[model samples]
Target chain A: MEIYRYSMYPLGLKKLIVPCRQLQAFLQDLLESTDHLKAVLVTDKDGVILAKATGPDLPDHVLEPAFSATFSVASDQSGKLGFGRNKMIMSTFDEDQVVQFNYSPLILTLLASSKANSGVLIAAGKDLEEPIKIVGESVSKAIQHEHKAKEYV
Target chain B: MLKPKVITQVLQQANTAGVHAALLLNPDGSLVSFAGGTEKDAKVLAAVASNVWFGYERYGKPPAANSVEGGEGKEGLRNLILDCEQGKLSITRTSRMLLCLVADERVEWGLLKAKTRTLKEYLEGPLNLVASY
Candidate 1:
C-alpha cells in the first residue's frame, strides 16, 4: 500500500516538490518519534495538501481532504466566531482520538490514538511551529520561483 | 455611549489599518452599526449573518451534544468564529453582537485580531452597558 498519496499538480506547483519533500521528512521523523499515527501538511489559506505520512490503515487521498476540510472548518470558525487569527487548533473527538493543526502557510495536522500521550503530542505539534513557518516561507518562495520561470517560458 | 461613535471608531480603526470593512450586527445578525472603507449594500450584512447562522446550525451543535463529557461551553462559541478566504470574509463574536470584518487579500489577520480584541473588550463593557439603557 502506498504510505503517501498525492495528486498531480501543474508545473507551477512542481517547484514546490523539493520543499514538500523536506517537509515530509521532517513530519515523518516527528510522527515516528511520537505516537502520531498520521500526519499531513496542507497549504494554508488554500487548503491544498502538500504532503502526507500515514500508516497502512489510512490512505493518502482519504486523509488529504479530511485535513483540508478540518482546516477549512477551523479557519471558518476562527473567522466567524472571533477567535482571532487561528494559529492552531487541537481537538479531541474522544479520549483516544485527537486532531491538531498549526496554521502557517503550511499546517501540520496529526491524528493520534487514545494511548498516545496527549500532552506530548500537543507539544510536538507546537514544536513544529518554526519548521512549519519555514516550510510555508520556502513554499511561497518556490511558488514565486515557479511563477518567474513561467514568465520566462 | 453613542452607537454612531462606537461604529465610527470600529470602522476607523479597521480602515486606518487598511482593512476592507468592519460592521456590527445584532445577535440575530441584523446590521445595527456599520462602517466600510468601500461602499457595501445593506443586504450583504444580512447575508453574512444568515451564513453564520447556517454554520452554527450545522457544525456548531453536534459537538455540544457530547459536551456533558466536558465538551460544551466554548466549542460552539469557537465555531462561530469562521474565516473563509474563498469567501473574503472574517467574523468575530461578542456577548451581544457578532462583529464581521471583511477584507480582500491585503488584510493582515494579526493586526485585525488585535484591533478586534480591543473592540471586543470595549463592546463587552461600556458598549453593552449603553445598549442596556
Candidate 2:
C-alpha cells in the first residue's frame, strides 16, 4: 500500500549544489537586515518546506507544523474573512509574526519580536518577491526532476 | 444565450438576498459565467477551483461514486459547497463549472440553502438533458 509521508529531496539536490546554495544564501541575505527575525521558512502549497532559515539550535521537526498551520490559517482567512488574496497575514502578541503567500503556491513565513519595525519587514518582504519567485520555480523544477529520476530507477 | 441567462438568474437571486459575489468557472478553472458585485478578476475563479479540487481530492469520495449518487438523487455531482464569512463556492459536476457566491457572514444560512436548492434543480434539468443528447 502507498503511504503518505513527508520525504526529503534526493541526495543530488541536497548536495551543496549551486542552485541550492544560492537559494540558501539568497534567503539568509534577505533576512539579515530585518531585526528580530526569529525565523523564516518557505513552503509549497502542499505544506512542504522548500527552504528555511532559523537559529542554529532550532530543531527540524518544528518546521513542518509551523508551515502547515500558517498556510491553513492564511488560506482560511482569505477565503472566509475578506482578506483580498491574502498578501500578508500579521499576528502580533508578545512577538510579531508575518506570513505572506505569493504566486498561489509559495509561502514566506517570518517570526519577529513585537518591537520589530513593521515597515522594514514589509519592505524587505517586497524586495524579496523576485528572488522568492525564482527560488520557488527552481525548487518545483528540482522536485519534478527528482520524481522523474525515481521513476526511471 | 443560455450561459448569460444562467449568470443573470444566479446574480439576481444572490443580489435580492444581499450576497457579495458569484461566479461560474469551467473545468480547467476558466470563467464561463459570472455575476453579482465584486472583483471580476479571473484569478479569483482560479483560486476557488484550486481549493475545490484540493477539497475533493482530500475529503471527497471517488468521482464515479459521487456521480452515481448525485445523478440518482437530485444532486448531480453537485460536489461540495464551502461557506466562508466573505463568500461561498458551489461546483457543478456536469461540466466542472463552479458557482461562487460571496456574502456577509450575517446572511441567513437557511436562505442560502434554499437558493442553492433552486439552482441545483435548474442546473440538473438542463445539464442532464444535454448529457443524454
Candidate 3:
C-alpha cells in the first residue's frame, strides 16, 4: 500500500487548528526528553502520520502504519478480556521497545531503547492526554468544515 | 522436564506481591503451571497471551529491515504490558517459556516489573534444565 505523507499542514487543517509544525514540535520535545528515544510519531486513527520527530539512532524501517494498526487491533482485542478499556500497550524486544497510547482519534507512538524506563514513557503518554484530545477535536471540526464545503460545490 | 513440585513452587512464589495470578506457558501457549486461578482461567490467559504475542509479531514487523544479528529478533515478542481499567497484565519471555502475571489494581508498576524480573531470572534455571532433558 502506498502511504501518503502529509505536509506540516495536514487535512486542510492548515489554518483551522494547531498547525502541523506545532504538532511536530510537541513530538520533538518528547524525543529530546528521553536519552534513548529514537523516534516519535503522531498518527491519526487510520495510521496517517500527521507529525513526526526522529533522533539520529532511528532504524531505517520504522513503518508508521504498522505501529498504528497493531496498537489498534491489540488494544481492541485485549479490552474484551474483562479488563475494561485498554489504555496503553508496551512491547520490549532485545534492543528496542515500542510504547503506544490508545488516545482515540489519535495514536501516540514512541520508539526507544530497550533499557529506557517504561514507567517514564507511560507517564509521558498520560501527560499527552489533554493535548491529544484538543488536537483531535480541532481536526474533527476541520474535517467537518471540509465536508460542508464540498457539499456546496 | 521440570518436576511438578518445582512448577508449583514457582507459581506459589509469584502469587505474593499483589500478583493475583501467575501462569507459565510454552511459547506455543500451552499452559505448564498456574496459580491463584482456576484451570479454565489459566487456559484462557495462555490463549490470550499467545494471540497477543502473535498479533505483535505479525503487525509490528518493521518494513524491509534486516533482522538484529545474533539476537532474539526472530523470536517475536520478548515482553508485553497491557494497562487497562481494572489492572495490569505483564508477560515476559524466559528461555523458551512465557511468564504471565495478572495483577489487581493495587499493584504498582515498579513492584510488578520487579517481580517479573526476579521471576524471569529464577525461571531461567529450571527452564534450561527442562530444555536439557
Candidate 4:
C-alpha cells in the first residue's frame, strides 16, 4: 500500500485518535534496520517523550530527562530567527550524526553511527515525515480525549 | 568564572585568519565568550549546539571521525564540523570548554580546524585549573 494507517484509543477515550500504531511500528523498524542506531525518541512540542527505542549497544542514559528539557528550550527559543519555523537541526559529531526532525508539535530524533549510511538515515526520517505529523495530531486528540473523560467522570 | 580576555584573543586570532566569529560555550548552552555576531545570535547558537552536543556525548564511545573508517572508542567527543547552507560552524573542546567557530562560506576549513585545536589547548590550562578548584 502507498499509504499506511493504524488506530489508537488513548486511555479512556472512545474516539480513535490519529493512527500511531504504524508510527510506533515504523520507529521500531527503523531501529531494527540500522545496526548502529543508538536510539529513537519522539517528543511533543513540550518535549514530552511519546515513544522511544534503544539500540543494541547504546545505554538508555543517552535519552535522559535532560534531553527532553533541552528540546523544550530549543523549540521555544529557536523561532526568532525569522526563518519561518525550524523544521530540523542536524549536528555532526566525530563519531556520529544526530538528526532531529520537527513535525510541528512532535519531534523525531534519530541517532546513527558515523559509519552508517547518511543517505539511508536521512531517508528513514523523510519516509516517516508525514507519519510524524499524524503522530502530533493524535497526541492532541489523546489530550482532548483525557479531558473529555475527566469531565464525564 | 572564565577570564574574558581568552575570548578576545580567540576572536583576534580568528579574525586575522578570516573567520567570522569565535566563542566559548559551556556544554549546558550557556555563553562564555563570543567575538562576532550579535549577542542574540550567539546565544541562540549556543543553546541549539549545546543541546546537540549534550545528546551526542552520552552515547558511549564516539567513532573517531577517522575520515570514513568510523573507528570506534569511548573518547566521548573530540570535534564537530557543521557544514550549513549559509556557511560552516565548527566546534572543538578543551577539557572543560567548547570553542565555536562560525566560518564564512569561503573560509579555509583545514586552517580553521587546526586553529580550533590550538584554541582548545590554550583554554585547557586555565579551564582545568578552575575545574580542580
Task: Give the number of the best model, judged by TM-score.
Answer: 3
Model 3 lDDT tens row, B91-111: 888877888999986788778
| C-alpha positional error of residue A4 in candidate 4 after TM-score superposition, expressed in Å | 29
RMSD of 3: 5.0
Clash count per candidate: 20, 2, 0, 1
List, residue by residue over A15-45, the lDDT tens digit for candidate 1: 6667678877877787777764554454565
Model 2 lDDT tens row, B18-63: 5655555555667656665544453565465556444433322212
Better of 1 and 2 by TM-score: 1
lDDT of 4 by residue, A1-153 (tens): 111123244363333233555667778888997867777778775556777776665654445434444444444444443334545555556667666676767778777776776557667877888878877776777677677656655
Candidate 2 chain A vs. true chain A: TM-score?
0.68
The candidates, ranked best first by TM-score, are 3, 4, 1, 2
iRMS for model 2?
14.9
The candidate that wins on DockQ is 3
Error at A83, model 3, angstroms: 1.3
TM-score, candidate 3, is: 0.81
lDDT of 2 by residue, A15-43 (tens): 42465457667678766766776567776
> Cα lDDT for residue A49, model 3?
82
Clashes of 1: 20
**Interface DockQ per candidate:** 0.05, 0.03, 0.48, 0.16
Candidate 3 local lDDT, A89-109, one digit each (tens): 888776778899988878989
Candidate 2 wrongly placed segments (more than 4 Å): A1-17, A56-64, A76-84, A146-153, B1-133
